[model samples]
Target: MAVTATLTSTERQIGIAISAGLAILGLAMAAVAKTGPMALHGGMALVLGIALVFYLGGALYDHPEPTNRRHAEYYDAPTRFGIVMTLIWAVAGMGVGVWLAALMYWPEATPAVPWTSYGRLRPVHTSGVIFGFGGNALIATSFYVLQRTSRTRLADAVSPWFVLIGFNLFCLWAATGYVMGQTQSKEYAEPEWYADLWLVLVWVTYFVVYIRTLARRAEPHIYVANWYYMAFILVVAMLHIVNNLALPVTWGAGESFTIWSGVQDAMIQWWYGHNAVAFFLTAGFLGMLYYFLPVRAQRPIWSYRLSILSFWGIVFFYMWAGSHHLHYTALPYWVQTLGMTFSVMLLVPSWASAGNAIATLNGAWDKVRDDATLRFMFVAAVFYGLSTFEGSFLAIRPINSLSHFTDWTVGHVHSGTLGWVAMIVFGAIYSLVPKLWGRDDMAWPKAVEWHFWLAIAGTLIYVVSLWNAGITQGLMWRAYDEGGALSYSFIESVEAMLPYYAARTLGGGLFLAGAFLCTVNCRATMRAAGDRVDEADRPLATQPAE
Candidate 1:
C-alpha cells in the first residue's frame, strides 16, 4: 500500500517539508564536495530525497484524507515497508557474504577493483546483514509489538515513517560508504562522522516515537517486549556515540580520525563491538522471540520471573563481557579476568531466556511439529543457548588463546547471527506476514518448510566447516615437533582451509537461497491481500462521538 494514502493532509505536508529539506541538504553536500566518495554519497541522498518529495507531492491533492477511525486501528504501513526492506537486505547482505566466502577459497575470482576488494566488501556484508537486514526487522517488529501490547495506535504516523526510512538511509550510506572507503576504521561503527551524526538524529527521533507511543498507551504497564526493545535502542546509541568519537578532517569530506588511539582505542572498539552483539543482535531479537514465540506456540511464557531475571542479567552482564575480547592484548590482566568472569556469568541469563522460550512450548509440540514458523523459533531458542554457551567458553583465557584470531571466532558469531538472530526473524516474519496482509497463511505455505530446512542445513554446514577450519588453523599453529619452534607455516595453514572455505561457500549459498524464497513468498502474499481483512486485528481505542 502507498503510505501516503494513509496520512492526513497535515502529515503529508510535514513529509513534504522534511523531504524538501533533505533534498536541499543533499544538494549542498554534493555541491560542496564536488568530487570523490562524499560527492557520490551526497548525490545518492539527493536522489532519495527528491524521489520521496515527488512521491508525497503526487498524492497530496489526489488521495482522500484518512478518517478518525484510523486512530482505532494500528499504523502498519511503516511495518510493511520495513519488512520489505528487511528481505531486500537479507538477499543483498547474504549474497555478498556467500560471494566473500567463495573468494576465500577462490581468491582469483575477486574483481580487480577497489569496491570489490575483500576489505571493503567485508563491511558491506556485515552492515548489510547486521544493520540492514537485522536492524530493519527489529524496527518493524518493535512497532508491531509496541502498539499491540500497549493497546494503542502509534502516537504519530509520520514519525514512524521518518524513523524507518531515515534508518534505512543510514544503512544505505554505511554500506555505500564502505565500498567507497569512507570509514573511521571502527568495527560496526565504520561510517564517517557525518553518517554517525545523521544516525544520532534518526535514532533520537526513534526514541521519541517510542516514548510518545508508550505515554499514550492504554495499558497500565509496559510489556516485556517493549523493555528489551527500549534497551536495544538506548544502549546502541550510547555504544555508537562513544566508540565513534572522531574529528572530521573537513566538514564536507567523509574523512575523519578517531579521537582514541593505541590500546585505549582497542578497548573502546571491542567495548562497542561486543555490546553491539549484545544489544543490537541479542536484546532486540530476544524481544522478538518473547512476543512471537508465545503467540505462535499458543502458550504463555514458562516463567514471568525468569523472563525478568534473564532481562536484567543480560543487561548487566553483557556490558562487562565485551572486555573478554581484549584478552591476551595490552589490556590489563585484571580487566581481562573480570571480563571472563562476567562472560561466564552471562550464560545463566542467556540460557534462562533461551530455556524459558523452549519450556514455553511444552504441550505445544504438536503445533511446533506441524508449523514451520513455530519451528523456526524453536530452533532459534536452541541455537541461542548453544551459541551463548560457546561465547562464554570462548571468553576464557585458555580457550580464547586458540579461538581468538582464527575462523573459530567467525563461526561463533554466525552461530549467533544466523542460527539465533536470523531464525527468530524469519519466524516472526512468517507469523506476521499472514496477519499483516490479512491472509490466513503464506502465499505458498510449503515454501516456509523449504526455507526452514535450507536455513538449518546452511547454518550447520557453514558453522561446522568453520569450526573445523578454525580448530585446524589453531592446532596447526600451536603444534610443536619438539624443536621449540612452530611446526606449521602460515601458508600450510591457509592451504588446509581450502576445503572448509568451499563448504562455507556452499552453506552460505543455501541460506541465501532460502532468504530469496522468503522475499518472493512475501511478495506473493502481499499481492494476494486484496480485500481480505482480519477484523479482530486492531487497536482497542473506543470510537469518539461523531
Candidate 2:
C-alpha cells in the first residue's frame, strides 16, 4: 500500500478559506452583473473558484510526491505552470493576430459578427500577446530567476500560487471582456476598472513576494538580473496605477472615465503605452537575457559594470522617450524635441545591452552552432539591437513624419516582438522545459531547428513586406502633380496594401505554425522519461550559485 501525501493542516485551512472566499465573491458578482459580458465573466470566475476548491481540497486528501524528489530544492512548479501558460497564450494570441492580418485583406470574411470583428479582436490579439503571453513568461521566469539568483526558496508557497492564479484571472477577464465590448478604451490598459483593481492586488503581492525572497538571499551581492526584474515590477506598478486612474460610473457598472483630458490625456496615454513596451516588454525580457544567454553559453557576462551602466541608462532614458509618440501633434514642440532627443540617446544603452549578450557568446561559437536554443538567444540579441536602432531613427521628427500612421511602424513593432521578444522567450522555454522535467534535452531537438527556420522566414516576410508597403504609402501620399495637388487618393494607398497584407498574413501563419510546433514539442518533452535528479534540481541549501 502506498502512503498518501497531503497538505499540512495550515495549508489546507488557507486553501479552503481562499477557495470559499472566491466562490462567494464570484457568486455575488454574478448576481449583481446586469450586462451579458459582465455576467459571463462572473460565471467564469465562479467556475474557477469552484475548481480551485476541488483542486485544493483533493490535495489535502491525497497528493502524489513528484517522481524526481531528489532535486527538491527549487520551487519549480509555478515556473512550469507559467511555461505552459506562455505557450498556450502564444498560440491563441498569435492565432488572433494572424486572423486580424487576414481581415485586413478580406474584411468581409467575418462581416457582421461584432465578436469576431477586427475592431474588438484587435485588443484581444494585442492584450493577449502583450499581457497574456509575454506577461506570463515574465512572471514565470522571474520567479525562477529570483530563486536561483537569490539562492533562496520563494518567500512563501501560497503567495506564488496566488500571484500566478490571480494574474491569470485578470488576463482572462481582460480577454473575455474585450470580446464582450467591455473596455476602458485605454490602449494596453483596456481592461475595465474591476480587472485593473484585481491586477493591483496581484502585482502588490508579487512585489512583496519578490522583496521577501531577496531579503532571504544566501548570496552577499544581488545578481544584476534582479535589478532589471525589480525595475520591471516597480515601474510597471507605478505606470499601471498612474495611467489607469479612472472613475467607474458605479460599482456595478463596467465603464469608467479617465481623469486626464485633452493634451494631458494624450500625453499620459502615450507615456503609458511607450513604457508598457519598455518595462513590461523590454526590462523583464532583458533580465531573462542577462541570465540565460550566458548560462547556456557557459560564459561569464563580458562586463558586469557595463551591464549595470546600461541598466540604469535604459531605465532613465526610456521614461522620456514616450513623448516621441506625440510628434507632429498639437503638443508643444519643446516636449516633442525632448522626446526625440532622449529616444536618440536611448540607442546607447539599448545597444550596449544587446552587444553585451552577443559578446558573451564570443568564444562560444561552437555552442551557437551545436545548440539551436543558444542560436535563438543570439538572434534575439541581434534583433534587439536592430529594432532599437529602428526605433531611434523613427523617433526623429523628420522620419516620424514619414513613418507615422504607416505600416512601417507596425513592421518595427513586429521586428521587436516577433524577432526580439518572442524569440528569446522561446529559447528560454526550450532551455527550461527539459530541466524542469528532469530530462537532458527536448523530446524532439530537431524540431527546435524547424521552429527556428519557420520563425525566421515568417518574420522576414512580415517585416520586409510592411517596410516596403509603409515606405510606398508614405511616398505616394506625399507625392504631388506639377500643380501641387495630391498625386494619389487614399483608396489608392489602401489598394496598394493588398499584396503586402497577403504576405503579412502568410508570414503570421508561419509564425503561428512555429508556435504550434513548440507547443507539441514541449508537451512531448514533459512526458518523456528522465526521473534521475540532477545538480540543477537540488534544494537551494545544497545548490548555491557559484
Model 1 segments more than 4 A misplaced: 542-546
Over 234-329, each residue of candidate 1 has an lDDT whose tens digit, in order, gives 999999999988988887799989999998999889889999999999999999999999999889999988999899999999998888989888
Segments of candidate 2 deviating more than 4 angstroms: 1-7, 64-72, 536-546
Candidate 1, 261: how far from true, in Å? Answer: 2.0
Q: Which ten residues in a row have the lowest lDDT in candidate 2?
A: 1-10
Query: Per-residue lDDT for 179-212 in model 2, tens only?
Result: 8888888889999887888899999999999998
Best TM-score among the predictions, by candidate number: 1
Q: Any residue pairs clashing in model 1, and if so which? A: none
Model 1 scores what on Cα lDDT? 0.92
